[model samples]
Target: MSDKKNENGISRREFLTKGALGSFLVAMGGATVGGFALPKPTVSPGPSRRYKLGDPGKFPVGTAMKMDKENIFLFRDVEGFYAITAVCTHLGCIVVRVDDGFACPCHGSRFAPDGHVVEGPAPRGLLWLEVSRTPDGGVMVDADVEVDLGTKLVV
Candidate 1:
């Protein structure tokens, strides 16, 4: 037997070096690619809560305004001040104000200004939220509470 008589006529040193290099390359590739295979963890939102919606004086009487951050529409009609959820009753999508009333972009759900369902698809009217004036000189919108559509905050 002779060293030159090794398998495929390759020396043991060359065989071992090539094997080690291939193993190292595979290990590096796995280390870099395997991390993204698992899905990332997500944090769920907390319970529905109330939030301050700013001063009531900001809105002029007889006008309706949308508070995008609060997801509510502040209305100050001749009757009184009230708040309606901007979230559509049909599919929880935010509704936008149209010439007649609110329109849901996710679906063709239409609601009257008073939140009454005016067209098909939407099963019910928009939600009326509890609105109140805080002693801290701000308007508070209680998301956890649902009030009647006729309810108003006489701010």
Candidate 2:
């Protein structure tokens, strides 16, 4: 309240104001340094989503093979070859092949052989991935690419 100066020749109000300003400047300096010291925002690359399943002839017709590492089911029907993701749409759990369809062990979600949702808890059907024949006569499946339910690669 008083404008009287202390022994240091600075008034109480001036001392407080200077102290507050110094603190604010120091805090801002530290924040700026911290921002610069932090690593730059970046996206690290991930593993490729494409997988090569050797010779289409190796897969017998009517064969439904599960690739555990890839989390996909490769099917070779009479029509052609198609791939379905084994990951459950409900909670990302791996689905197991059942007698009539695929069943999720974690949440009881079921999907038909064609990847259609047969039970609830899952908001959508399984993902049908893009399958294509490579230049070398090998079959490849792209898990990152989604295709229509009935889409198949007739090699």
Q: Give the candidate number with the greatest TM-score.
A: 2
Steric clash pairs (candidate 1): none
Q: CA lDDT of each candidate?
A: 0.83, 0.91
1-155 in candidate 2: lDDT tens per residue? 46799888999889889999999999999999889877764665789999998898899899888998999999999899999999999999999999889999998999887878998799999999999988898999999999988998897
User: lDDT (0-100) at residue 108 of candidate 2?
Assistant: 91
Model 2 has an lDDT value of 0.91
lDDT of 1 by residue, 42-64 (tens): 55468656877677767778878
The top-ranked prediction according to lDDT is: 2
Cα-based lDDT at residue 32, candidate 2 = 96
**What TM-score, to 2 decimals, does candidate 2 have?**
0.72
